[model samples]
Target: MSESETTSLEAVDIVRILELLPHRYPFLLVDRIRDIDSDRSCIGIKNVTFNEPQFTGHFPTRPIFPGVLLLEGMAQTAGAICVLASLAKSKKPEQVYFMTIDKAKFRKPVIPGDTVEFHMTKLNQRRNMWWYRGEAKVDGAVVAEAELAAMLVLE
Candidate 1:
């Protein structure tokens, strides 16, 4: 691959994600992020467990990971990379806001013990706004997909 075509793969653990994002426990959906190619793409990992708070009432009899959280995971995954990319340029944003979700679809129910990978690819970017297409996959099969948009707010 040529120099411009070569992309460095980076991984961000929970600690750094915490610094880049405002989400906390019970809200921080992404456990780790990997294969980060600047702000263009990345894969965020979420390990579903039976002990998560949502399972307590989402469905007492047959617990299932809520689909809305899956979409949030995708947005968080994309938002993280955008912040990371901005930091590389010495620009820090105060907050990253989820702007829109489109073409969202849930293909399967995610349950405990499932390790989900939210694969996100940038679709468009302008100024401080970014649009991404994300796919949440388990065992390499897509469980959910959506197109998400986010805007970075500066101080």
Candidate 2:
């Protein structure tokens, strides 16, 4: 691991996450940000449960977490990092809008009872647009990955 990866990160709990993000329960995918390296990278956490509404219809039997939702979770993780960085610079947290998703791949099915860890790194940023690469892991196994782009809407 490089020095940037090894550097210790401060944890941001659910309360702070909620303040930084505009999502709410049932739609909010991220539980907390486990570690943050400002605008460079961060790790996000989500505990999957059978009670989640998606599981009810995603599959009545042999329920599985939706791949699109996994992608959304990763996007949310990236958003949190940007929001934290903005906050640090004394700028109000702006709403991040998805610009694009590319090279998305699902390697394994995520089910209820699995704890997902979303690891995201900044790939590039120009003006208000940011690009990121992210992976979703369960118990150290990669379940999903994607390259995503977003734009900050300052209002």
Candidate 3:
């Protein structure tokens, strides 16, 4: 794709994200999605905050965003784009179920006030299932990564 084409792609905001994903507050890790290339790739953003509920129990004096949530963010990012792609085809699924997580690793701790980006790239797709490789980054540095697979269940 040309640079211009990439730049022209519109971002998916929180409102549309809410419509695409079933996760609610505290669980909804992705705040915004951008640089979408159909179901091929996209970047999901999550702004970490000090007042979030997990901070109180995750740690009292020191709070760090859970690594598990980072993985979930990656899955959500991939799943949302999958749903968006299906919607474009006029086939809406009843639910997107997370099927698997593999090769997950945490390289750094994500703390309050950090804006994490989940960069997801499609690895494969078959029938109603899709697989993606995701890297979680903070300040352009990789903090975590994983391979996630999900299935779209139609009604």
lDDT of each: 0.92, 0.85, 0.92
lDDT for 103 (candidate 3): 98
Q: Pick the candidate with the highest TM-score.
A: 1
lDDT of 3 by residue, 1-155 (tens): 34444435578999999999899997999999999988889999999999999999998888999999999999999999888877766688999999999999999999999999999999999989999999999999999999999899876
State, as a TM-score between 0 and 1, how close model 3 is to the true structure: 0.94
Residue 144, model 2: lDDT of 98
All candidates in order of TM-score, best leading: 1, 3, 2
Q: For each candidate, what TM-score against the reference?
A: 0.94, 0.91, 0.94
Model 2 lDDT tens row, 1-29: 23343345577788887887888999899
lDDT of 2: 0.85
Error of 2 at 15 (Å): 0.5
After TM-score superposition, what is the CA distance of residue 113 in candidate 2 from its true location, in Å?
Answer: 0.5
Model 2, residue 28: what's the lDDT?
A: 94
Off by over 4 Å in 3: 1-9
